[model samples]
Target chain A: MQTETDLVTGPAPHWHEGVSIIDAMQDVLLALIPITITGILIFGTGALLVIITCVTGAVLGEIVARRFKGEQTNLGDGTAVVTGLLLALTLPPTAWWAVVPLYTLGGFLSVAIFREAMGGLGRNRFNPALMGRVFLLFGRTTLVYLAPYLIDFNPAFTPWLEELEVVDVMAKATPLLRVVEGMELPSYSTLLAIYEGGSPAETSALAVILGIIYLIYRGRISWRIPITTVTGVFLLSLFLGQDPLFQVLSGGLLFGVGFMATDWVTRPVTDTGKIIYGLGIAVLVVFFRQFIAELWIGYGGVAFSILIMNGFVRYIDKLTARRVYGQKK
Target chain B: MAEKTFRGGIHLPYFKDLSSGKEIERVPVPEEIIIPLKQSIGAACEPTVKPGEKVEAGDIVGDSEEFVSAPLHTGLPGVVKAIEPRITGTGSKIKSVIIKVDKNFSAAKPDKARNAEEVSKEEIIKAVRKAGIVGMGGAAFPTPVKLTPPDDKKVDTVIINGCECEPFLTCDYRVMLEKPKELLQGSKFLMQTMEADKCFIAIEENKMKAVNNLRKHNTFSNIDVLALPSIYPQGSEKQLIQAILDREVPEGGLPFDVGVLVQNVGTTVAIYDAVIYDKPLTERVVTVTGPNINKPANLLTWIGSPVKNLLEKCGGIKNKPARVVMGGPMTGTALSELDAPIVKSSLGLVVMTVEDSSLDVDDFRPCVRCERCIKACPIGLYPNYLSMAMEENNVVEAEKWDAMSCIECGICSYVCMSKRPIVYLIKKAKEKIQENKSD
Candidate 1:
């Protein structure tokens, strides 16, 4: 019979046990549930289609990549599904259905080639969802020139507000555009409407709120990054005399804060680093909306700015490393 | 003063309450004790006691010529059963001497529990060196060499690191709270050996009760209690000095470079025991508690005891333990085998079951270049670039990125939004680059 004995020194742990990365990913997925529901309610079936297409595309891409590389597939972990869902949230609500293949390829490229193939989940420096979205953004821009030949028409050229049905107003006005254009504060009642914004993930502020709360409660994401990001945007907008409410509600702000900016793979690992990352994303978002107001340029600002920040992740970590005990900084 | 801590350290759920306040309990010698020849960081000792030999407690069983190594002692008076190479907690092979306990054998009670009578500083140093003591607070660096600073440098102060700053660790706290007299006596011993003018017992504010206990022990005017802000790695040499003395050990330099020597409260106690009891470093204080265990206590266990026995003693697993970690949450390695023997410097044996399920490993995507890692790094190193460089196998670039400086604390990976394992990249770079240099 084994006897219970107290530990005296030898190695650091007398016994061993720990939680796996798969469990952590599940918590993150649970957190996204609220935001996902909000996006679906506001954008109607289009939002749901985008989420389905992107997630399916990402997971399939992962399976194919792993099979090709002679590695075992792990779809049950739910990471690929979360990446797809996050990518869907960053798109325009009226985004063309063509996003399905483009985002799918992007997700696969990020997760499989850039992430797993390179080093597996925790090793990649770039955010897979953002990378997939960036690919779609780049792909869309290419389609603009080749769109007539490909589809013979462009839906984006149509005035989105005029095309929306009465119920669609809830999804017509994206939070970002409102903040950028310096629009008056929308009432909580208006914000609650499902189809108030035209942006893919921004229409349902209520859904995003639910999502963030879920993420926090589930421990998938830290409260620090999203909170700091929104706080930074709020503070910076105020310093420039931009309406704080408009900034908070505008253009993917909620969606970005709730989901995109909080991606555990791409953000900082230190608490202070997360705060800096949030502040940086906020500052860049405000800077682009305030100064450069170009149609294509501003749409990609968050992704672009975040990409730039990701490049300096190591530097940020060093700058913020806690002072070693018994030593000077 | 600015709060001191290491960057990227994990805030593991410290089940310290299980054993934090309890007196250290000595486990009876089991039917057999598996004593490994190599326990510390340096060379594995050559077995001095043969199989079938009857050895007394405190007798040296293994000795090494390596300067950075410590000798191993027999924890029980028994007949050696066999000598064989076996895997230890670190997953390395070392020669182990197995001794079958005599059912009638009882631990000889220590002669007297008394502080050291003021011996000459030289005599104390000789005793410490002879007893084969090392830093028991984790690093396992030989303690005598640390106490004997270079002749060129003058020492002014000695800081006793009572900051069991790592989460899930309370062995030092137990030493300070229950063995206060010995802890103080150890500090006094170090002060005399180093010829230091003052000694500061730096404890984190989170451990206020332990700090209070040490202060009330009435050791010496020079030995003062300092309550530091609670933070991870606060007990690190550089951070501790900064917290107490406002001094910095130059980067890529030793604590002696800063005119001070830092010792853990546990180490000081070990020193006191070695000199007072004439015992070599054999047994130590270990914390055995986790979510799955029925009981957690600070166990005074003999070195080289199989961890599986300890877990069985703690009522075994309540559920399938997620992973068996050999250290604190941040820096500990997950154990792959239960048969591995525990060695010196085992600060904690945490059975962490609940993980942040959201942070699970999925397919990694491209880095979006968010500087969250940069902002989060306490060491001021850029992880993103280091990772990029590492991905490209640009060891030269990784070096330029200061990849070597990363302590692999997992903070970068912990707070990452994209869930990138920035720590792994840095670790790979460090190991690969160091290998290249060695070759």
Candidate 2:
């Protein structure tokens, strides 16, 4: 009953809007609203600029990738925008202007090239934003160190990157490193200052908390990874006699745990796997911050831990699967 | 007390205003009806009536080829015109029998009203199977087959899915308001058939009017009316079962695995018709709404009616339709061809029109690994990796990640900020993988 032309069109006659995937993606963007709002409120305008820039970069990166591949552009999916916003949140507030293009390029490479080639979106194991941040940190560490000055570090002065103090930028260590190194705890008020005691992104523990709560509320991400990561860090810090509050609120620990490390794709799927994943990051973060004395590598620790766990997710899922009725494994 | 709402359900402005109060208006029958053979899940029925044969409403035009398939019945008294291939709601092209309605063909409306009396289990089952009733909750899976619990399993509870949880569709709500008695009767019949210990009707708290109306005059004491927390996919059989009975339909298994049978309210009403009047599944109440549909109202449309006919009935297209779906916006399939016929499982025919097409597809870009899809998935499957495995043509990896367990609810696709076609990718993976397995 089939015609010759049917072979070229493929099997089975069907009609679809060719818009199914796009609609699905839109729904995801809408769901991220609450957490994105929390991020904007916490980091102020610097974070907002990062969000806008990252989203724009992500879209542009996809378009460029599609162009390079000689394929039709699907810039309408908003996947790039999501990548941009997520990458922005993970960046240091005082990061150099050069870091924006570097990270955006990295995101395109990881998300558009590697991830897209592996299959775009949900198929990628490594989070694009995290990959972008990691790429920037590793590839141009010198430039990243200079990134905070490129953007307007002074929120009261101009709030735009072009209006910032150029060469007179002051260097500061994150709070987690200070606590691990046995420095006296800065007063809560001082700790909340603009990129002084910690990274601008994680300086405001209050904002991270709000974002985390919003994520949990929206069910955009699970509480298991973040809750377990935060809990593990807090409990492990208590064991090491480090201040739990500093560990919880320091560096990108909150942002990493609340946002990145808990990424559903790279992290293990099973509850047991999630717990292991969280605990692994906690241990690595502590080791990096304390023994290595490298708080600079703390965020990298989360990325590495996720990469390791992503490899072992299959076995972990097998071990954690519920026993099906009337089936012998 | 904690709110049982799940994470990641979108809250769009529900435009259920027009049809919420207006009684369902029966639209005029089309000149010709194109009835798809495989409307329900499982194998498509083989045609029994050949071309040039006269057929009447309730006459079986197609016979079931397998235990899973439902028989096809004529929706109108007409002359058998042609049996040709046509596209279905799922976008799959299947052989459909087209019947041209005879002029002056206002046949007698089958008597559907019934007395408040208990029906025997066997009679209910037989009637439901004969009526070709499927889950009108959009799946259109044969309802009787679902009710018949396996011999090995025991069903003690039947849950009525009144969640209508999908944001825009209000056909269930209109049904609840208009014919609570029929739904209640259908529930009773289902309870009796399943030999259930109890029955529960789960309605969202938002549908206060329907809840109140059902509660005030509800006759079935055995059927407890519980107001469930409003959540997307709460209308899904497994999710609804979890919320009401606290029973989990095991991953990679049917609801019978959990010793529960979930039925949509509309499907229940269809059962009432099947049992009371021997009426075959023909006409169904469809919600023709959304921004693009003008004068939005709940319609009693016949099976095989074209999308254009219904849109025209709803005062034509309000604006340039960005997308046309056969069900709710969340789980509904986008109509690539408006000529596709309305089938038995249709609950609402939605026409969404937004100024920005970006809202439809942001741009198929790279996934940022936000974990939004993972969090939003009620089944807890990792869509990101699964989509990857599918892309690589690695069925083993996809299967390992529990790809088969995916209910295909589109939640992952919906929640993905990257606007990635996670659902489509996964669907393609599932198809390719299944094809490989079969080979």
Predicted complexes: DockQ each? 0.10, 0.12
- Against the reference, the lDDT scores of all candidates come to 0.69, 0.69
Best by TM-score: 2
Residues B324-381, model 1: lDDT tens digits: 5676755665565666766777776766553422223235444544455665565666
Deviating ranges (above 4 Å) for candidate 2: A1-282, A285-329, B1-13, B109-119, B354-363
| Cα-based lDDT at residue A121, candidate 2 | 49
Residues A129-209, candidate 2: write the lDDT tens digits: 777777755765555466545344455554465564332222444565555466666666554433343333555666666
Worst 10 residues of 1 chain B by lDDT: B354-363
Docking class of 2: incorrect
- In terms of lDDT, model 2 sits at 0.69
Instruction: Locate the minimum summed-lDDT window of 10 residues in model 1 chain A.
Output: A2-11
